[model samples]
Target: MKNYQRYTKMFSMPPVRSMDWAEKTCVEKAPVWCSVDLRDGNQALIEPMSLGQKVEFFKLLLKIGFKEIEVGFPAASETEYEFLRTLIENDLIPDDVTVQVLTQAREHIIRKTFEAIKGAKNAIVHVYNSTSVAQREQVFKKSREEILKIAVDGAKLLKKLADEAGENYRFEYSPESFTGTEPEYALEVCNAVLDVWQPTKDRKAIINIPATVENAMPHVFAQQVEYISKNLKFRGNVVLSLHPHNDRGCGVAASEMGLLAGADRVEGTLFGNGERTGNADIVTVAMNLFSQGVDPELDFSFMPEICEKYREFTQMEISPRQPYAGALVFAAFSGSHQDAIAKGMQWRRDKKCEFWTVPYLPIDPADVGREYQTDVIRINSQSGKGGVGFILQENFGVNLPPKFKEAMGYAAKDVSDKTHKELKPDEVYRVFLERFVENRPLFDVSECHFKQLAGGIEATVTVAEQGKKSVVQAVGNGRLDAVSNALKKHFGAAYTLTTYEQHSLGEQSTSKALSFVGVEGDGKTGWGAGIDEDIIQSSFEALCAALNNLFVSRGKD
Candidate 1:
């Protein structure tokens, strides 16, 4: 903290007031998404992807609905050059998708870039040079005129080469460190480049504004973008694009704000994989628009598949906390969050809601190939009754009674707390069976008989306790009540039947009946569940199990 005085802000603001982008609440539509994963993202990796891996990634970008893809700096290396040639020679480039290649604003590099994209169905030759004040004074040691002319020459050569090849190949130029440059000067250079291309309606040139190294807040970048969008030449024909880095961890925010500032395109990598903190995450930005009900025009419905392939191709790990595409983004481990989510899901089902307004979830997990049982309601030590009950109902057909779910919740949390691991749904179900349904440590019911009577139903119940059997008779209004009375008489126990519920496990005629019972004794309640083909048998077994729990609570065998 003491060294903080060593640094100062390096960004420059636009001269004019360009705060109009601040008035927008959200991005109204999806921008033209261009994935730089093969270029920017791959170069940042510890081990750059091989040619085959790059090819696979390119195919993936096309499948994900990207219209423009910045393949790589084709003039920089043989591999990059060969990758573009591979796409063009093998007819891998789709008819609708345009492959864009990067180059320095030098004659030989510009010529090599043009050769790299030869015979492609559609392509954009992108050129850029450092235009920041620091680059001007230190890195390039060039005046503003020299830098602007470099961009202009690159633009002129791209036009001449395209004309000679009889290809209407589009042109794109970037003031590479746009964020660190004076906004007005950056605009002047972009206009100079645009003048050479003379972009038309059919061949609209892209003027990319890259953060290069993010140095300011997102609002500052948005204002700068607005200045360029307002003053750039051939505004009607030019596509204003934003390429933001994540130095301040505001790449996605800057991209969104840039779109609000009238930029039409975004260049980013999937999951924000790129240099330093990474490029703006196209997935996060697109899904942000999707969550706001705007169609992002990209297919991320199979997000898991995309994440897997990204890891395999690039050897970069996707963080478990990454937005929308992460493993635990939809997971709710907090007890309160789990409870609210459970209630919200039930409310949706009961009301047949047409829109998603679930608590704690900005979007439906199912919308992106995630399941509610496995992905949404994850059971850990912090889980509660609602989450436990939700897991039972959603994964299995076992819906615990409202009061009994609380007891089951404690049993599950105890196991998870002791094991120090999250419990899967089936493990939770096993906990339910071990503690409630199949539990009979104190006693078990061997047999039961019932006879109809005028006042109530008479029941003859046979009970087994520690390998001993006993028979008792009692009468009550219902079969379960009669059995409860019989058990209390035989065991000399004191308790009240506080809860009873039942439902068929399935719709078939031969389906089993499941019953739950609760007994209150000494100001505490013990719960149990039973399943059998016969309703009467299941109810009796449930009563017996509940009594056994009550006996155990009183320290009786």
Candidate 2:
């Protein structure tokens, strides 16, 4: 907090205002997605992926429905060059997919790049040069004219080589540090390259503007993009692409705004894997569209599978809070969040609604291969009754009575707090069982026979306690009441049967009935549960369990 003068803004705004992009509320369509995982993502890893690993990742990109993938800078390394050759020779590149390779504006690298894609059916020979003011003054020691010629010369050479090789290879060029370059100068250099390539309608060229190092707010970048989109020559015959990094944590924001600025394509990696803070996450951008009712054209329906493969190939761990693909993205551990989510899910089911309007969840977990029972309502010390009850009903078909859910929630929360860990669904069930269900400590009913009477039903109840047995008879308004009266009379126990409820466990011919009972005594209450094939027997067992809990609560057991 004391080092106030240590930091300063590193980026500058464009000289002109391009506020048209700001009027758009959201991206109305999915952009052409290009996965740079094999190149940009792999190069940033501490241990770059092996040749086989790169191949595996290339296949994954195809599976995810990426039509254009930046395979690698083949001319940069033997592994990269051979990886392209391997894909070409093995026929791994699909006919519909076009592979893109990166290269500097230098000649030998460009020549070797052509060699690397010698037999490719379709490829984009991407070339780039730094055009920023710092690169001109500090790194390249060249004038603005010199940098502009570098891009022009490279563009001319790529077209000539593609012509000689008799291959219809498309071309792409990037002003490497577009964000740092003057917007007017950047447009001039891009137009110079466009003049050389003479891109046509069928063979459209790509002019990728990369935020090589993010420097300013996202709106500034959007202004820069709109400038290029509006003023560039051959705009209709060009694919304006964006490649933003996350130095300032605004890659996704910049990319979205860039699309609104009339850019046609995006280049990013899964989970934002790239140099430094990483590239714009294609997964996040695509899922953002999917949540808005636009089909992203990417198959994230098996996100868990894709995540697993990504981890195995990259040797990188996906953050637990990564949007849409993380383990805990859909999980609600807060009491209030769980309660709202539980009520929302029940509302949907009750109304048989077709739309996804669940509280706290932007989209249904099931839509992305996540289970609500396991992934949505996680139990912890902060969990509440609705979540606890939802876990029971969804997982094991054991629906707790609404009044009893509070007690069940307290039992689960206490166990989780004492253990200092979250309770799984099965653990929650076990806590419920140990604390409330079949709790017969004071006495166990060996048998119970109900007889019809003029005033009410009479019950002959046999009780077993401490290896001793006794039989007693009583009358009440109902069979459960008669049993409760008989037990209280035999043990001199004084309690009021306050709550009773039952439901069938399943819809089978011999479905078991589950009963819940609550007894109030000594200014406190006790709860119990019982399940049996016969409803009357289940109610009798429920009464016995309640009596035992009452005795335990009174310190009389």
Top TM-score prediction, candidate number: 1
Model 2: per-residue lDDT, tens digit, 478-508? 9898999998899887889899999998889
Shift in Å, residue 483, candidate 2: 0.8
Q: Candidates' lDDT values, in order?
A: 0.91, 0.91
Give the TM-score of each candidate. 0.98, 0.97
Query: Which pairs in model 1 have colliding backbones?
Result: none
Clashing pairs in 2: none
Question: What TM-score does candidate 1 reach?
Answer: 0.98
- In candidate 2, stretches whose alpha carbon ends up further than 4 angstroms from where it belongs are 1-8
Error of 2 at 481 (Å): 1.8
